[model samples]
Target: MTATESARPGKRGGTGRGTGTGAEAPRLAGVPLLGSLLDLTSDSLGTYLRARGEHGDVVRITAGPPGLRTELHCVFSAEGVQQVLASQAANFRKDNAVYQEVRDSFGNGLLTSQDEDYLRQRRLVQPLFTKRRVDGYAGAVAAETASTLAGWDRAPDGVVDVSDAMMELALRAVARILFGTDVDTTVDVVDRCFPVITRYVLRRGYSPANFPRSWPTPGNRRAAAALDELYGVCDEIIARRRRDLAATGATGATGSGTDTDTGATTAAAAGTAPGAVTAPGAAPGEDLLSLLAAATSADDAEFDDTELREQVLIFLLAGHETTATSLSFSLHLLARHPELQDRARAEIAAVLGGRTPGAADLDRLPYLTQVLKEAMRLYPAAPVMGRRSVDAAEIDGHAVPAGADVILAPWVTHRHPRYWPDPERFDPDRFTPEAEAARPRYAWFPFGGGPRACIGQHFSMLESVIALAMILREYTFEAVDTEIAVSAGITLTTTGPARCRIRRVDA
Candidate 1:
């Protein structure tokens, strides 16, 4: 069957279970004992693609040596994705080995939390990401983007590592918006340790060997050290924010003297120590840290310091890393396709007339938004979402046994020919209202879907759009490498530094 025909929502064509028909899913045969773990560790995206190609949308992949101790049901079809992420989400949960790995580092933060705790934390955090709250962050996003570009201008070489640059920019942006304090001490520590921790965790998670994090293994030690540093940083930031709130007698609510009615931080409350680049109009309580610190659940249950640290650390890491990856990939794509870059630049120029973009300008920059959407479609930041079946569940009429790992891969679904034609092409127009309206909801879920979807989705999109506009406004990027190579871990990122030659655009 053709890729197009096979990818249809309910089409069944492979050596696997019949789509929409009750049948046992086909299992991939691998070497005795190891199963497909080696293939997965080496090239996860390639493995999934090959599995879906050969075994159909839903395939059972066994892992573990000889005993086949673990089985993962890889779901590629939109129908199956909806089943796992939405329709039958109650039957799937985050308490799986994959999330346990995340929890080992992040604790019971929103991403790794399950059940009642998840719902309570979600409610407490949801208000902070509302459209109004996210818009308040636009100034910091633009300021940091412009500041980073200025530094690049003074660099000895015109060549820049787009990946590192984006990561730093995103880190600073998120720090400024979330911390509202001179978190340089914390940011510096996080910047140094974040990569080490993520890389170590990814390797351990994918490895067939289930090494206990408590083990004295070299990788575990390094990851533990990084986690310690991160925890220390979170502690310092939380303590400082508490001190600031106490000094001002602000409960972090409106009219608290630390923040305006709009929740913008006051200069004194913003913790602008010498050399600190504070976000203008920001207040002490305006940031997420302060809000979280002062927040209470419906029952008035407050988060203790450790819980607070977990949430803050997770946000700092997740907020920056995911957006940075997306921005790097977006820049790489634009550099590779100069025509699209020019078109995006033209749209930015027409909309802002060279002024730095603000949250208000976002609605007007449809093409730039489309460019970002398209880039994410091609290289989704969170390539795969995993859940464990709480009980036996039916996905596309195929029975998924309890305790099985349910994998929904955006990387595969986004490129499925039934949902996206000429899927490999860089076509921003594919995100046009008409085209998007024509596809199923799960066809391109870069930010995921359902109640458990990314809480920072709005924040991420706004930050990326602002950053892309600011960068494109100031510079025209030229690809220095013939090809851009990417690697997937906790998030999808470029394998190495994405090198690009930067040229200042004429005003």
Candidate 2:
């Protein structure tokens, strides 16, 4: 049973403000030497929830041993979440080990850059994500989803892996939008290589010490090979974009994978950039890659060829993976609940009525949007996000040391009994405007919070809403895999196929 709504872990303040005075955060001790390492990595969702339930909103988890131990300050309260991510965002920077590894692999794009560098990058790229701008990409989402539904039509016994389907749909849609028609070579390279690279990052990120990349160990050699391929393809693509920009002189930004090992720099025979993109695509120089390559700062600064590659990689990773996670989980959740599925499908059919969804359709289909939001609340794309405390800070009166690692677990926060009744239950009604207005802002921050929030949020919403609305409307899906077991890496990857059985609504 949940505690009363007013029964907070401790004294609480308004949004982003924690009420207690200076004190030590409750320490969570675990297995000898490894501390909480085994419990956390094995099942972080359960671990974080148990920690909050036993200790309070603010718990300290120390992992590793002696001089090599890492102290993690876990903040679970909505108020503390706001404090760490919004009001006191300046006190927390993206200097965590996992993030550094990300920057090393994906480059210092908006997701990792901080301070002045972040501000300049934000300024240059923010305009491209505004609602008006993102709305223009709906065609890409619809086209890709239409293709996904068609592929599902060929599935044997009406069974399809929605997880793989959503992942492919999101990657292809974002990639097409980003690179336009000339990106046939990127999709496959990214799809194959991202997993190899991220797995290495997750392993190295949590270790107390690591062998240098220059070492020719098995892991190092494999990662280096993946990096070489990934970097070479993206570098070629960047070079190609620069060449194109110099010729036609237009500007902006672009994701997804391809099927061939052909490099992205060179177009296929007939000078056509070949791959799988077959939709109403963007005009010349209007694709996201072109825009980012052409973007100039207020001070007239622009991303160098290297910086452009970095930002491009980040866009592809952050844009498609998170959106795909949300979409997959959303469909899986609805499949498990027939009533909710019917309600959402009815909403889609009433609004979309077999016509392709448009950017304007986002508003006209509010109930379906709520369904997506509900799914996200249960399984956030970024289940666990990390930050580093830059200075001593007070949260609910507990003092955090400078340079300590801080964790803002949205997966746990979204389940706070104070805000969510029957926290584990799937209920889209919890997201109605009236219900949303009643809660604190940070109570459900899946896209993160504060100024450093994911810049592609609008793009994500557009893609998810359009895709889900379309998928649900066209097909009647029943859950084949009722339980979704997930393990977190860079994003929440389902442990299995996350399968569902789909039949045409007309049948």
Listed per model in order, the count of residue pairs whose N, CA or C atoms clash below 3 Å is 6, 17
Best by TM-score: 2
lDDT of each: 0.74, 0.76
Candidate 2 structure quality by residue, lDDT tens digits, 93-188: 777677767777778888888888887887777666666666667766777887778777789898989889888898888888888875567889
Residue-wise C-alpha lDDT for candidate 1, range 1-507, written one tens digit per residue = 000000001111112232233677888777777777677767778888888888888888776654335677889999899888888889777655545666788788877788888877776666666676667777777778768987887755789888889989988888887776665776788889988987775655555456677889888898888889888878877888888777876654321222223464333222233234336436656777887787764454667889899888778767887898889888988999999999999998888774556667778889999999998899888877777676776788687776666778888988898888889998999999998998999998887777777878888988899889878988998898747776566777677668888888983
Error of 1 at 76 (Å): 0.4
- Go through the candidates in order and give the C-alpha RMSD of each one to the true structure: 6.3, 8.0
Q: How does residue 211 of candidate 2 score in lDDT?
A: 90
Off by over 4 Å in 1: 1-21, 208-211, 253-261, 264-278
Per-model TM values vs. the true structure: 0.89, 0.90
How many collisions between residues are there in candidate 1?
A: 6
After superposition, candidate 2 runs with Cα above 4 Å error: 1-21, 251-280, 298-300
Error of 1 at 44 (Å): 0.8
